[model samples]
Target: MAYVIDGDKCDAKITWLPVSGSLKTGELVELIQLVEEDDKLSREALALKDIFNDIIEEGLTYPQLGYHDESRFKSYYLSHAAFALRLANSGKVIGGFYIKPNFPGRCSHICNAGFIVDMAWRGKGAGRFMAEQYKLLAPELGYRASMFNLVFVSNQGSIHLWESLGFKKIGVVPQAGNLKGIGYQDALQFYFSFVKE
Candidate 1:
């Protein structure tokens, strides 16, 4: 059955709440490992020749936002600047998210985020849940806007959902994504504004 889940108790948009929690630091390592695994969710790693592969080899289509070198990705998480969230029910993590300040100085008010759900959990509203949480959480974390830098234009589900949540298409990079078999495709940029409440 369809249910309603709000960013907080205030904004009453209804969806579903399948999970909740701030991902632990230790769990960040676990997510990195999973992201690098040679599986469906690991598409970001498909271009990598090694765990420590060069970013250029992966092509621009790759969602490397989460797969940066050990020093970079970890520094963001360790510095308490980037945060990851996991969807959990009854003590198990089912899905996850990575979010952080988009810039260092004046642009700190803007944040960026990425999400992933267990393939087994896809089509179950987990993505929606996490997004709703972000709407609420971003402001709480001192962010004014949450930007999605490189959304695949073909990812209709996400495009539709983000629009429903009031995110706007701000720009597009022509032929910025390398689609396997299909060659390159445009990368759509999106912005979601989160105001103080």
Candidate 2:
């Protein structure tokens, strides 16, 4: 049930999965819309509030993302999508995730990733499956470790999922994220090492 994905630099040890009865699909069009909507909320609320709306409108694309021409949004998701996974069922996109080097130059050895699952498909072990894939894929892409920069304190499910996967708590930035109606909340950072030294 598991396969390894190897990249140019290392043996990923990742299990990149394909649609195989892991889930059932409803409407393909609706699924994409659901992913977009959830992405909009996360970008606007629990993420950087500066260009929240713009990022939502422009989306995580390359060259042109909303009104801005350049952003980590494009660089990570659009540029480094080679090390990624697209989860679907019945030709409908259930989830997608991407892993990128967390920084440039000296910090390029470390990586970061983001996963988004359609709202309707949540609570069905989709995220857990994707997270496991990313952890393995990251190492093969020449990364020694992986990091989740900002996890909203209110998102108990995600916090629990990452922690259960052996990712450690690096630090917390209090009242750093705005949850729309909920004002501001703490953002937690998590890290996982492929090779523990």
Candidate 3:
């Protein structure tokens, strides 16, 4: 399926949700689209960049090595339809993701996405919440399926999250990730179809 509308056109409003199993009541988070026109070094963008770079430094999840400057981060994450999650009251960016066609032309019906949650905010359901939003927003962007090419085997939380969301492990890439301190590790490829076939 071709894009119903450009990814940047898909938008969502600020939403407040209670932290699952927490006594702190509800927290407000605003999901905002990231566009090329946004300042590359804006406060929100910089916060997201820090989180992303932290993940990259962990060397177990994403493939990129070293650090990403503002320009590089924006080029990679904001080049397509991207979104950022922030505390509505504090305006602190806590998480974000990017969606883009997995392949060219006819195969573009399938999209690939990358996600990151602030280390401080993990386990509070932000990742899962963003994932659930992705399930809804991706189809609206005209994608029929979502595919993750390299979910590291050691990343059990991510693997479990994807599976819990109804994504299937379609294949494994042997030694797909050359991680720091861990040497080579296998990677799982996950797929989820939005259309019933």
Candidate 4:
């Protein structure tokens, strides 16, 4: 399945929902549970849950998860420009993406984004669908380019998906990712500059 963005196409019954507010804490907790407990998901997610949970739960504030990494919860990444993917037939959040400034001030025009597909939906095209939607949505959000800063080298499916969507491999940092099955491997950086239509 794919998201209809200009020329991009997908046959799945799905819709892209614009992110309105932060994920509710209850929903976030459930999401964290899913990420942590789901054995079918990519091992990278399971391993990072140790660090990822802290980042998210700390921002769960109004309640503090204490000593959590707040670095990943940047206001830009949680902005309304983000998107939630759901079934067109039924509003189930199968996946989503967040958009944020890749750098401050001078380089803010170039954005950064991340996508996560729910465990139940991983093999069902949710990831690619979100990517296509993001490309179309990025320009509307005032970004001229988008970058994925740390795509793990072992995630071949994602690497291929991004490349298919017009993102280019800009560079790689050797042994930056310690994925579960793949162990320590190169981490790749991808960049895509949108052409105004």
lDDT of 4: 0.53
Off by over 4 Å in 2: 1-76, 82-89
For each candidate, what TM-score against the reference?
0.60, 0.64, 0.85, 0.61
Clashes (N, CA, C under 3 Å) per candidate: 4, 1, 0, 1
- What clash pairs does model 1 have? 4-14, 4-15, 5-15, 61-178
Q: Model 3, poorest ten-residue lDDT window?
A: 16-25
Q: Residue 81's C-alpha lDDT in candidate 3? A: 75
Off by over 4 Å in 4: 1-80
Q: Which lDDT values do the candidates have, in the order given? A: 0.53, 0.55, 0.80, 0.53
Candidate 3: lDDT of 104? 68
TM-score of 4: 0.61
Error of 1 at 87 (Å): 6.3
TM-score, cand. 1 vs. native:
0.60
**lDDT of each residue in 1-197, candidate 3, tens digit only:** 33432444234322332222211236777677664555646676778889999999988899998899888897777667777788777777889898887776678789999999998888777788788888977887788999999999999999999999999999999999999889999999999999988
**lDDT at position 69, candidate 1:** 60
Full candidate order by lDDT, most accurate first: 3, 2, 4, 1
Top-scoring candidate (lDDT): 3
lDDT of 1 by residue, 1-197 (tens): 12222112122222333333343222221222122322232332322222223332444334454445645543332223222233332333444455566655667677777565544455666667667777866676567898887877867887888899989999998977766556777888889777745
Every model: Cα RMSD to truth: 11.9, 10.1, 4.8, 12.8
Error of 1 at 100 (Å): 1.0
User: Model 3, stretches more than 4 Å misplaced?
Assistant: 1-25
